[model samples]
Target: MEVYSYRSDQLAASPKEVFQIVNDDEQLKKIFTILKDIEYSTKGKRSKGAKFRITLGVRNKTYRFRNEITEYVENEKIVMKTKLKQGVITTLFSVEPKGAGSELSVQSSIESSMGVRMFIMTVKPVVKSVMNKEMKKFEAAVISEN
Candidate 1:
């Protein structure tokens, strides 16, 4: 299993506000250009066990992953797991109240299939960079909304 984590801080926003921004599908479309499409499969709103089909570009290669929300603690954390063609990926979003704002952290891990471990090793750096860039974009979007 290979792990990569990125942390970004945005000021003057409550945990609820941050969670709303991140959980909103329409808002997400505006924040990340790499995401081509997202279809959520839960009733009225977001909740644990809600499934989504996420189409994103990774390393210039478009991939679609089906992610299921494994855990959702309002204003605190969200955990999602996906099984990609190359591996299994888990993403955790954590929000902590800081002063009058909040600090958000994303921790993700990717475990490649035995046969494709070499490919994952070779592309680890690029993957990490992409993840960092995405997180920065998310932070900027959240901060601007405040």
Candidate 2:
């Protein structure tokens, strides 16, 4: 398994505000350009055990994945687990109060087969670059909403 993580700079928002924005599917699609679609596969309050089908467009190809909310803590954290053909990708989004604002942290772990692991290692730099760009967009969105 391989892991990647990043913590955003402080933004002019509260932890609850950050959590609300992150959980809003419509806002997320607008903030993250690579995301094509996100539809909830399970119906209920926004909490742990909920599922979603996500579609992402990357380099002209569309990739779809099943994502489940493994853990959720209002105003604090959310953990999503996505299953890939060759592996599982777990992502955690956490927010904490910082002075008058809040900071958001994101972490992603990839557990894959040997072949997929080798492939990931080769493109790790590219993956990191894309992730950084996405994070920047997220930060901008949060700040703009403040």
Candidate 3:
């Protein structure tokens, strides 16, 4: 398993506000440039075990995947899991109050075959750059909400 993590700078928002933005589909699409679209399968309120389909446009190719919320902690954290042909991917999004603001973090674990692992190794730097930018954008969006 290969893991990549990212943390955002403290934003001028509370933990509850950050959590809400991360879980909101429209907010996600607006902040994450690569996120093309999200289709929720779980009706009504979202909670543990909720499922959604995400289509991401990356490097000119569109990849679609189904993700399930495996863990949920209101105003604190959310963990999502996705199964691919090669392996499974798990992502955790967490927030904590820092000073008068909040900090957001993301940890993603990829368990895949050797070929995919090699590809990930090659593109890890680029991914990190993109994730950093996304986090910055997220912070900005959260600040704008205040």
Candidate 4:
């Protein structure tokens, strides 16, 4: 498995507020610019073991995947491990309040099958760039929400 991440140095909202926004699929969908749609397969608020399917539009192509929240910590962190057509991707988000702003970070662990390992190398950069862009969009949306 290969892990990749991005952290932001700006203050948007409080960690608690950010957590609320991220925990709800509807709020999260509004913040994701590239998201086509996201549906929670399970009922109730987002908690550990919640499952969701997400479709993201990127580079003129749409990629769909299903994920489950394996870990959830209020105002602090979330870890979602998704099953893709080619591999298992684990994504983590962490938030910390700083002096005048909060620090937000996202990490992804890509566990590829032997057959898809070679393809991962070629797509890693693209994935990183896309993740960066998406996080930025999410940040801006949350900030504007307050």
All candidates: CA RMSD in angstroms? 2.2, 1.7, 1.9, 2.0
lDDT per residue for candidate 3 within 55-142, as digits (tens), equals 9877788889989999889999988898776567899888888999877788988876787788678867877887788888888888
Error of 4 at 63 (Å): 1.6
Q: Candidate 4's residue-wise lDDT over 1-146, tens digit each?
A: 66577888776688887787786767777677678888778984468998888898888999889999998888999888989777788888899998766899888877667767887777879988887778878888778878
**lDDT, residue 82, model 4:** 88
lDDT of 2 at 58: 73
* Colliding residue pairs in candidate 1: none
Q: What is the number of backbone collisions in each predicted candidate, taken in the order shown?
A: 0, 0, 0, 0
lDDT of 1 by residue, 1-146 (tens): 66677765654688998988977888887788778899777763467888888898766789888998889898899888988777778989899998889888888777657666776678778878877787778877887887
lDDT of 4 at 61: 94
lDDT of 4 at 117: 80
Task: After superposing candidate 3 on the true structure, give the runs of residues whose Cα lies further than 4 Å from its correct spot.
Answer: none
Q: Candidate 2's residue-wise lDDT over 29-103, tens digit each?
A: 898888999888789436899998989887788889999998999999989899977678899889999999988
Which of the two, 2 or 4, has more TM-score? 2
Q: By TM-score, how accurate is candidate 1?
A: 0.85
Stretches of candidate 2 exceeding 4 Å from the true structure: none
The C-alpha lDDT values of all candidates are 0.80, 0.83, 0.82, 0.81
TM-score for all models, in order of appearance: 0.85, 0.90, 0.88, 0.85
